[model samples]
Target: MRLRRHSLPEPRIQSKHTGMLQRFYNDVVLALGHGCGSSHLAGWRRCPPALTIICALTLGLSCKVHAQAAGNDADNANNTPAAPTCLPDGSGSLKARLSGAVQAELVWGNEGTECTGAVRPDGGIRVRFSHKDGVDGGRLVLLFGIAALREGQSAKALPVNVTVIREGLGEFYSTQGDNKCTLDEVRQEPLVGIPHRSRSYRIIARGFCTHPARAVRGNGVILLPRFDYVGRIDFDAEDKDETLEGGAMTAQGRMKQQ
Candidate 1:
C-alpha cells in the first residue's frame, strides 16, 4: 500500500559494497518472484533500480528475521524433545489378525466420541487388538465420520471426510506404498452388526499386492465387515446454494432390517 502511494526510494549507490548488495538483492528478488505470482524470474529481474533496492532492503531484513526464527525453532525442538515411544520388531505392519467372534468396533463422531467428525480427523486415540501371535497390536486412526444410513443405500455412497492419521498401522493402510496394489473384487454386501442393527455394509473386496514384500500381504477378504459394504461410488456433486446438488453417487448394499 505504501509503495503504491509514494515514489520509490532511491538507492544511495556509493561503494562497491552497495553495488554488490544491489546485485544480491536482484538475484534474491528474481528467485522469489515466483512466490509472489510471477512465473518466471526474467520479469522480476527487469524491475527498476529503485524497486530492486527497496525489495533488496526489505529482503535483507527478512532474511535476518527468518534466520533468527529458524534458530528459535531449533532451540525449542532441542529443549522440548519428543517423548520416547516403544519400538516394535521387524516392520510396522498391523500384527493382529481379524476373524470370527474376536471383533473390533469403532463409532466415532457419535454423542460420546471426541474425534472423527464431518470435517477434520482430529482427536484420534490408539485402538489395540490382541494379535494372534500374542503381540499386542494397535493402530492410531480417526475413522471417517458416519451419517445416518439411508434406507436401501450402501455405506460406500455416504459422504464422509477424514482429517489426520498418526504414524502407525492406520498410516500404513491409508498411505500408498511404493509397490502397487490391486483389488480382486470390490462391491457392497451385507453389513450385519449383531448389536447395532442399522443400515450398514461390508465392502466385499480382496486386495492383492502387485509386488509382494517379505512374502506377505493381507489374507482372505476384508474381515469382520470392517468394510461393511461392497460397491462403487463416484461422487460428482458440487456445493452450491448452501447445499450440494447436481452431484450423483451410486451405492449397492443391503440395509439392515428395522
Candidate 2:
C-alpha cells in the first residue's frame, strides 16, 4: 500500500482573547501599585484572560480550533492606560494552584530567637522567614534588617539571604524536615532597583521545602511536593541600617523556588 500525504496545519488567527490577557496584566499591575491587598486577587479567577489562555493552549492544538482560539493582542495594548513600574510594599503574589496572594512584610529580625540578640550587619542584609496568611490565604513574611548598605551595592549586590527556621512542618502536613530550610536555587532580578531613584529591588528566590507526606496515585507513589512557594519579591534597604527598627523599612518580593 502507498503512504498517504499530509500537509502541516496553519497557524491560528487572532482574536480578542489576546487583548484579554494583556488587560489581565494591566489590572494586575494596577492592583499591585494601588496596594489592592490579597482580596483583589479573587477577581483573577473571574478574569477573562484565564479562559482565553486555556482556549489557546488546549483547543488550539488542533488546526481547526486554532483560528477560533486566536486573539487580538494589540487591541488591549492600545486601550489600556500607561502602567507605571509597580513597586509593592509589604504585599506580593504567590504562584500556586490558584495563584495565591502573599503579604511579605519586612520587619526587624531582632525579635526572633534565632538572631540571638546579635546586632544586624552594618551595610549588610539579613532576613528570616515566617508563614503568613492573607485575606485570601497564606503567604510569607521577611523579617529583615539592613545596615550600612552603600549605594554601590545595588548592582552585583550580595544575595539578601534568609532561612526558614520554623519547626512547624507538621502544622501543614503529616511529616517533617521542611523545618530549618534555606532558599536554594534562587533567581533574582531587580525591578525598582536600589542605588537608584526607585526604592525596591525585584527578586525571585526558589527551593521552598517539600511537604512531609507523599501521595499514592497508583502502584507507585505519586510524588507530591508540598509548600514549594515561589513568586516575586521587592526589597528595600534604604533605612534601618545597622539598627533594628531604628528606621522604617518594607519588603514585598515574588520568588520561585523549584
Candidate 3:
C-alpha cells in the first residue's frame, strides 16, 4: 500500500501576515514529518510535545519582531520635519502699473524674487529687485539720497532716481539727466527678530512718475503712474549715528563735515 502525502490547509486570512504565518506552518510540518518518517498530518500527531512547542514559539517571536520594525518605521516618518521654503512670510514685494512702451501690471512677490538694499558711501539708499536666475527678466532700482532714515519714520515728496531694465529689450531711466519721479511717501519700520547690531530696516514706499522713463538709447518710454514696494536696507555704525543725531544734513553736507 502507498502512503498518501497530506498538505496543511492554508490560513483563512489573506495578507502579508497570513503569508508569513503559512510559511511558519510549512516549516513546522516539515520538521514534524522528518522526525516521524511521514510527510502528512498524521506525523504532526506523532511528533514530541516539546518539538511542537518550540516551533510555535519561534513563529510568534518572528511575527512580533516584524511588527515592531514596521512600527518604528512609521514613527520615524511622522517625526521628520518639513523642508523650509524661501521667503515664507511674504516679507518682500513689488507692485506697479506700467504704461507707454511697457504696458503691464507688474506684480513681483517673494516667490522666485530677490530684493536687496544697502547704504551707499554717499549716505544714499539703493534698493534693487530682480528675479532669481532670470537671465532675460526685468529689474527695478530705486535710489534715495537721504542722509539718514530711522525706524517708524516717514519721508514724503523725496526725489528718487528710478531705473527699469528689461534684459534683451532696453533700459529706461526716470530721467536721463534729471529727476522725474518722486517718492510720495516712504515709511521705515524695524524688522522683528533681527539683532539691533545688524541695523537692518524694512522700508515701504509708494511713488509716482511725473514723466515717463525714457530709454537710454531708444525712443521708448515706460510710464508708471504709481508704484509701491517693500524692501530692506542694511546700515552701518556711521549711518546709525547719523540717525541718532537728529541732523537734517544733506549727503554732501555730511561728507563736508567729515
Task: Give the top-scoring candidate (TM-score).
Answer: 3
Residue 202, candidate 2: alpha-carbon lDDT: 33
**In each prediction, how many residue pairs overlap at the backbone (N, C-alpha, C within less than 3 A)?**
14, 23, 0
lDDT of 3 by residue, 41-130 (tens): 566567677466866777776778688889989999899755322233677888888788667777777665666666645556656665
Pairs with steric clashes in candidate 3: none
lDDT of each residue in 79-168, candidate 1, tens digit only: 864432211111111221223222344322112212111111121111111112122344333222223332233333333321112223
lDDT of 2 at 139: 36
TM-score per candidate, chains pooled: 0.20, 0.24, 0.50
State how far residue 94 of model 2 sits from its true place (Å): 4.0
**Deviating ranges (above 4 Å) for candidate 3:** 1-88, 132-152, 170-172, 192-196, 237-258
RMSD of 1: 20.3
Q: Higher-TM-score candidate among 2 and 3?
A: 3
For each candidate, C-alpha RMSD in Å?
20.3, 26.1, 12.5
Q: Write the per-residue lDDT of candidate 2 for residues 1-258, one digit (tens) a residue.
A: 221112323334375554544454445434442342324444444555554654564443444434544544455557875432212343322232111121233332212212111124344444333433334344333332223233223322222222221122211111112232334434334446443566334333333323322111111111122222222332343233321222211111111121
> Per TM-score, what order, best first?
3, 2, 1
Look at candidate 2 and tell me the lDDT of residue 235.
38
* Candidate 1 stretches greater than 4 Å from native: 1-133, 136-179, 190-199, 212-258
Ranking by lDDT: 3, 2, 1
